[model samples]
Target chain A: MAFKTSVQKYTGSINKLEFGSGENSKALGGENVLPFYTFDGNIGGKPLIGLEILDVYPEKWLDELQQIYGDAANNAVQWARFVEEKFSPDFICLRLEGADPNGLNKSPEEAAALAKEVAQAIKVPLVVAGTQNHDKDTKLFEKVAEVLEGCNVILLSAVEDNYKKIGAAGVLAYRHKVAAESSVDINLAKQLNILLNQLGVKNEDIVMNVGCAAVGYGFEYVASTMDRIRLAALGQNDKSLQMPIITPVSFDTWSVKESVASVEDAPEWGSQVERGIAMEVSTAASVIAAGANAVILRHPGSAETVRKLADALINN
Target chain B: MERFMIIGERIHCISPVIRKAFAERDAAPILQRAKEQIDAGAAYLDLNIGPAERDGEEVMMWAVQLLQNEFNNIPLCLDTANKKAIEAGIKVYNRDRGKPIINSADAGPRIDMLDLAAANDAMVIALCAKEGIPRDTEERLTYCTEMLERGMALGIDPNDILFDPLFLVVKGMQEKAPEVMETIRLISEMGLKTNAGLSNVSNGAPKHVRPIIDSVFAAMAIQCGLTAAIVNPCDQRLMETIKTCDMIKGNILYADSYLEL
Candidate 1:
């Protein structure tokens, strides 16, 4: 007998969520099967790759990245324009890392203004992320959402501690999308989505950052959590977890010892540049396979490779 | 909500190993399979000895005592064509974890299984069919209502009677898939628990695709309110799908090691 493939009939699908505005807007999710399981069902829109551009100058970056960005790294708008024109990423993610109270302590207004400038400079969609501090992120995101109102940008995260404030301002008031960030746990991820929904945030206006970790540094938790979330969304028709997942791979990967350790410090670990790119690419690929609808990457090389991987697996 | 129940279907007579184990009265193979299923998160083990005919009573009794004694009195379902075998098994069954399930009673000749279940105060799998497959959801529901009423008349608690929608293979009965789900929904609306031989839906399917079909069907059926299933808990993909579905449906609390559970 000729082999006839068994097709799955999924009752639920990942929400097809569109981020950004106008001609450059891109949609993620909408898949009715496990990631890249096109033989069973629709894979929907291909997973997206966004380049991470920090709001403040990246003083802590390695020389490999410094060589790539040069003086453009000093300004958020210039950095966004440079990566957009040079690497042509699907979107630009402006992370307000400098706004942390323990860091540069940049004011919310300054971060918001820089975000607006970057948003205007890039034709692709803009994703604005905040520092990890709940109070700082709440204020930063609120200011950024208000300033970038009607831009239809995505706020990088609305965490459990500050979902109410960010969800209200970004999703409710400004009509922007909110990525509900959770640690590497499916229950926490689902709970945040439920909380966001109860706060009157529509399902379409919500995305999920179920959390990310560098490869080999507890990356299994991230992968397994994503798998469980996707399975629940499609297999069980779970509405709370149906939102598309967007993992910030760059932040986790680049900060790891594998990527950051100096060649002199670890002479046997090969070139630092190659290690960093490999870390980013490996993490991105793993997350995509584990069912991330989109991933944010740092190096242009890693972003290019991941974009090719996504196109090859999903487009064909 | 109750956690989704996995009635492990590994200890059946069809497998040559198990059949041999039964014939020789060997505890090694049967105990190994039972322990594997239990460790894989099966809530109850279905002991399908098929038709023992001459030795049905002795075989069922021996198998039940052997497994229960070794596995700390694990809950079980007695499956066979011989009603006397089911009764023999129940004679030595333990109810520490849960009541033994009689697998099963139908609207036809096996209808008396309900009497056996009620007499023993045991649970019963009520098949929603008479002889063969039902014509449609309506027929299945008809059989279901008949069995439900019979169990009630026998003074059996409705909760102890798990309605079986009788999963039909998708290879030839593709159109009946939705009907099975509908039957589950209707049974759920009646406030009754439902389970099925989940692997039946993937029978005749290629080995590689059986897990996909079974898992997908399990998920869809679960969404329609299926409360339990007789399945091979050893299929990792299927078990993962079930765990994910249970968490999504709010039956089990989610944890990082939920799959391990």
Candidate 2:
């Protein structure tokens, strides 16, 4: 009776589409007509957490995350292994941050080698991240895609400027999955998905990245946009955009001053560890509440806390 | 209030010998239409037997059994002028698709049908027209309250009694349209659910303009808490309007590269 009587009948009737296949695929779980409608029906499955692994040493990481990762942060393989064994993440998301022109500008070979090693070592599914540089990320994901062949891996991104190569890499190489990230623009998010499909990528092999941002930085705009996209998929049967969503929770938080700046910079920001954790948690939870299928995070404790909250929210 | 229920308004007896075919137990036409509407996203078919004054019960039984047998027991709204036909149809309905819905009861003699619905544990539509169409929002509320009280006396949950605000036509009675919307708001405020013959609101309007009016009204009514509606799934524009309205209302979340489902 606690459930809204109006929604009780339609609770379990909503359908969910899971992405990926084999060892790395996600179940694309949840019910209740819309996301976080716990009062309506049973929500099972914890929000799938992907621990983020950097392509290079985080010379600028928030002290809280740096303390936990330490030396392992520089080695993608060690980071992947540590995340899997210690954090026991449902998945490992490797970001080739070093390849970005603005950053370390590492070679594609390095990206591929790191991807191959992490793909081979990680027992769970792997999500390969490209540097945020549109052109370079496409090229980076291409080599990474080939190295992670048949591992049922999900490529980090295919954006408007370079989706063809990344989508082609995902479709032709190992039949791997691909995440289509657009700016906060909803139409662009859907257009990229269509573009990925145009490159012969199957719908089931696509996960949408709605481009998460930290709290207070146009977060509600992002949330409302995501909500609109979900309604279009479920209510209108807009096949062009009906895929699971993947959110870069860690990367979004890492860019914010609240997570990285010392507590002295903003006395009202609270403890660095708690602020950082809260930053990631709030951003990730916002997306999940907006119907995110998967979210990538940095610290293990923040991921665990989000996972517990997700489990409770879904199962309730 | 309950989630919206879209009652499929297709599959009626008076539609060009279709009922003749159904009553005679020939299901090709009925089955074909049922699939078409359901595939188009209809939740329930409103099976109107019309005023088969000579053989109401016979036609009702034939239509219910034939439609149910072929469509995996698709739920139906027994639509008929004869109460006996409605009762007869309900007696034979298969209950998996959902509860059998009695086409309607009202504040007058139709009030008697509530007891039958309560006895059968089925849902019933309550029309807010007692002697005639209510003149204002207050009248609609009065009728709704009476029906709610009647259903409560029968031990029926308020959620099970769907109120119909009796959508007015926009072509001739354009001024009265807002009154109907106000009535919709009033019923919704009582924490009760309501629906309308959505097509009726646009009657007498131009072919292309009817759906536009209906869609706008439906969306506005939904915003005011309308929960169910009788509509023609054949109107693709109206369905699209409903989908978009749901998106804007946050009833559905945005989908990734694809829309959310």
Predictions' DockQ, in order: 0.09, 0.14
Taking the tens digit of each residue's C-alpha lDDT, what string does model 2 give over A95-169?
Answer: 788888987788988878878887777788878888778888877888877876777777878887888888887
CA lDDT scores, all candidates in order:
0.91, 0.78
RMSD of each: 19.4, 6.2
Tell me each candidate's TM-score.
0.61, 0.71
Native-to-model Cα distance after best TM-score fit, residue B34 in candidate 1, in Å: 46
Q: Number of backbone collisions per candidate, in order?
A: 0, 24
* lDDT, model 2, position B185: 83
Candidate 2: tens digits of C-alpha lDDT, residues B45-138 = 9987777787899878988898899878988888877888888888899998689988889888788778878988889999987997778877
lDDT of 1 by residue, A65-163 (tens): 888999999888888899988999888888998899998899999889888888888899989888989989999999999999978998988898999
Q: Output DockQ, candidate 1.
A: 0.09
Lowest summed lDDT across 10 adjacent residues in model 2 chain A is found at A8-17
- Best by DockQ, which number? 2
For every model in order, the fraction of real contacts preserved is: 0.16, 0.21
